[model samples]
Target chain A: MNSLEFYVDHLFRKYKASIQIQDLRFEVLGNLEAKVADLTANGVGYDEAVRMAKENLPSIDHLIDGNRTIYINQFRLEYVQITLLYMVIGWIVAMPLQFIRTGFIHWLFLISSAIIGVVYLVLLANRKNINMQKIKAFNLNAVFDLRKQVWLVWFIFIGMSIFITTALQFGSNIWFFRPVDISGPYQFAMIAIKYLIPFASIIVPVIFHIAPKLIMKYEVGENDGYKE
Target chain B: MGDNSISRDIIRGHIDAIILRVLCEGDNYGYEIIKAIAKNSDGKYELKEPSLYTSLKRLETQKLISSYWGDESQGGRRKYYKVTSLGEEAYEKSLADWKIAKDLIDKLIERQD
Candidate 1:
C-alpha cells in the first residue's frame, strides 16, 4: 500500500460493490493508507495492510452525511422560526388588505393567500426536516445514523399545522369583508401573494441551509472543540 | 529518551533535529531514520511509526521537509524525505535548545562522584 493509487485500485475491487470516487476525498484515503502501511511495517504484508486501510475508511458520505443531518436539523429549527414569524407578519399586513379597508371581495383573496403561505411553510419544513433515521429507514444500506429527533419534529409540525389551520378555518371570528371579484388582476395578485413568501423562504435559507451543511459534511476535522 | 525519565520529553522533541541531522548529507526514508536514531544512541533510542509520521507531516506543513518517491524491489514505492533549508534552520534551533538544556541539566545533576 505504499503507492496510494495502486493500493486504491486493488482495494476498490475487493469492496464487493463497484464505486467510483467522485469527490476530492482521496486525500483522507491516501493518509489512511499511509498509516496502514506504517502500522504493518514490521508485521503484515502489503496486501494485508491495504485490506486494513479499506476497512478503516467507512463511507465518507456517511461520515459527512451524519454531520450534515445535525446541521440541517438545527437549520430547520431556525427556518421554522423564520417561517412562523413570516406568517405572523403576513397576517398582520394582510389584515389591512382585509378587515380595515373591508373591501367586499378582498376577504376571499386574503384568506386564500394566507392559507397558501402557511401550507408552503409546513411543506418546506417537512421536506428538509428528514433526519438520518428516516434516511436509514428509507435506505437500509446507510452506514451512519442521522439524529432521531427530526422525525418526531416533522410529525409534530404536520399535526400542529393541520390542527391550527383547521381551527382557524372554523374559528368564531369569521368576519368576511365585501367580496372582491378574483377574476382579473386580483386573481394574478392572489397567485403572486401565495408564492412570494414561500419563494423568499426557499431562497434566503438556500444559502444558509445548503452552504453550512456542505462545509460541515466535507470538514477536514479542524481543531474545533467538536469531535468531528 | 535513553530510558532517562527526567529529560525524556525534552529529548523526544528533538527527534526532527536528530533525523534531519542524519539526512542532511543524504536522503533517507522511515526505516533508515529509525535505524539512525537507534545507532546514534547506541541502541538506546527508537522512534515509533506514529511519532515519525507525525513529525514528518508537521515538518512538511512548515515547509521544513520535502518528500519524493522512491522505488524499491521489496516494497512498491516509498516516500523518501530530505531536510529543506528551513529544516536546516529548525535543526540548528533544536541543537542550540538541546545544548542549553543539557548544560543546565548537567550542572544540576552533577555530583562529587
Candidate 2:
C-alpha cells in the first residue's frame, strides 16, 4: 500500500468518526513526527526512531479530539448557573417598585438595576456561537436564554439591596435631624450584601473560566477521551 | 460512528493486554504503539486514538505502565511509556488468557463450519 493508504487504514481502525481523512492523517503523522523528533534529539538514528514510533501507538486517536465535547459541556453548565442567579434577582425589584409612584431617583434606580441584569446576560450570550458539534445547540441556546431571564432576576435582587441601602442612608441621614433612632444592625447587613454578591459572582466566573485553561496548560497531551 | 458496541467490546477486551505486552518490549509513545499494532495486525486490526489513550490512562492509573517525557523532536514532544514489573506480570497473564480465548473462538468457528 502507498504511505497514505497505510496511514489511512491505520487511522480508520482507531478513529471511526466521520471527520476528514486528512485530519486523521495529521493526527497520526503529527504524533509520529513528534516522537521521531524526540528520539533523534536523544541521539537515536532516524530509521530506528521511525521504526520505534511505528510500533508504539495502539489505536487511541479519539482521546484528543473528544476533548472539545467535554469543554463545551463545561461551558454549558457555567452559563446555566449564571442564568438561574439572574432570574431570582429580577422578581425582587419588579415586586415592590411595580406600584410605587416615586420620584425620578427611585425610578432611575429601579430601571437601571433591571437593565443591568439584562445587560450582563447579553454580554455572555453574545460572546460565543453555539455551533459546537456533538453538543446539542438548542440546549446551549437555552442556557443563554435562561441567562437573559436570570439577569432580570439578579437585577431585581440588586435593586432591592440598593433600595434598602438607599432607604438606610436616607433614614440615617434624616435620623440625625430626628428626635431618636437605633439602626446599627440594619446598617451592618445591607452594606455586606451590597458589596459581597457581585464580588462573589465575579470571582466565581474567574475561577470557572480559569480552571480549564490551567488544566490545558499543565495537561501533557495524551488520550483525552475524544479520539475516535 | 453510530453504534460501536461490538468494536468497543472487542477493543476493551484486548486493550490492557495489548498495552502491557507492547510496553514489555521497550518504552514507547502513543502514536507509535498504535502504528505498531497496525503493522503487526497486517492492517486487519487497528485502534483509534481515543480508545488507545483511554487504555493507556487506565494502565497508568493502575501503575501497570509508566510514561515519561521523551527528548524526541520530530513534530511535537512525545510522552514515552515503559512497562513496570507489575505490567510485565500482567502482560504474561493476559497473553495466556488471549491464547486460550483465541483457541476457544477458533474451535467455535471451525465447529460452526
Candidate 3:
C-alpha cells in the first residue's frame, strides 16, 4: 500500500466496516493518492508529496455526516432484541395452532418461543455492559433506512406465517394418513381464515415504529462528545 | 477572491455553489475539481480535502449532483460527479442571488470619499 493509503486507513480504522464507510474510504484514499501524484509530478520528492497530502487533510470528522453519534454496539444489540421479540410473538401466535393439530411439535415451539422472550428480557437487563467506544454517526437517513428494512421484515414474516399455517392445516392431515379434505366452498373459506390466524403476529412491526426512539436511547450523550 | 478574511469566509459559505459551477462546465472528479478551483483563483485559494469531500457529499445528498465511478483506464477508478438538471437550476439561482448580494454589498460598503 502507498503512504497515502496507509494514512487514510489509519484515520478510518476506528469506524465500523460498512458499505457506506468503505465507499468513503475508497474516495478518500483515491483523492489523496491523486494529490500525491500531482505533487510528485511537479518535481517534488515522493516523501514530501505524501507529507503534503497528509497535511492537506486537516480532519475527516466533517466528511462523516452527522451532528450526533451513537454507540454502534448498543444499536446492534437493539436489533437483536427486536428480532427475538418478533420470534416470541410469532411463536406465541402459533401456540394456538396446537388446538387444531394436537401435537408435541406445537408444544416444543411454544416452549422455545418463551425461552427466546426470556433471553430478550435478560439482554435488555444487561445492556449497560455495551462498550461506549463503538460509535456510529447518527442521521435521519439511517432511521429511514431502518424503517425500510423493518417493512421488509414484516412483509417476510406475514408471508411465512401464511405459508406455514396453511401447510400445517393441509399437510398435517395427510401426514397422519388422512385424505386431503376439500369439503365445500364455505368450509374451504373457513379453513383458510382459521389457518391464517397467525397473521395476528403483524403487530410485531409496531416495534419498528418505536425503533427510532430505542435507537435514540443509545445515542452518546452530548457531553461525552465523539472521540476523534 | 481577495486577501480579506471576511471575503474568504464568504467564499467558504459558497463552496457548494463554486463546486457546482465547475461541474456545470463538465463532469469532473474530486482532485480535478480542486485543481480547477485553485487554477481559477490564480492559485490564491486551495480547497481543503475535507471541505471538498463534505461539500461533494452534501451536494450529492441534496440531489444537486450525481456521482459514478469511472473505469480503471486512467489511474485506478476515480469517482466522477456530473450535475443533474436540478443542479443546473440550483447553480443558476445561486449565481443570480450572489450577483444581487454583490451589488448590494458594493453599494453599502462604498468609500465615503
Using lDDT as the measure, which candidate wins?
Answer: 3
Best by TM-score: 3
Name the lDDT of candidate 1. Answer: 0.52
Give the proportion of true interface contacts each model preserves, from 0 to 1: 0.00, 0.39, 0.44
Instruction: Estimate TM-scores for all models.
Output: 0.39, 0.43, 0.54
lDDT by residue for model 1 (B1-113), tens: 46675455555657778778877868877656766777888887666544555466667778888877666555334567888998899888888988898899798989848
DockQ of prediction 1: 0.05
The 10-residue segment with the lowest total lDDT in model 2 chain A: A132-141
Off by over 4 Å in 3: A67-228, B1-3
Give a tens-digit lDDT track for model 3, residues B2-38: 5676667777789999999999999998999999999
Reference-based lDDT, residue A53, model 1: 57
Model 1 agreement with the true structure over A54-169: per-residue lDDT tens digits: 55443333322122223334344454455455445545554554533444234443554577567656656676456522211111123212223333444565566655653554
**Ranking by DockQ, best first?**
2, 3, 1
Report the lDDT tens digits of candidate 3 across residue range A48-152. Answer: 999998887744654565534677777766766776666666566567666656334456556656776676677677677756467766564566677788778
Say which prediction, candidate 1 or candidate 2, comes out ahead on DockQ: 2
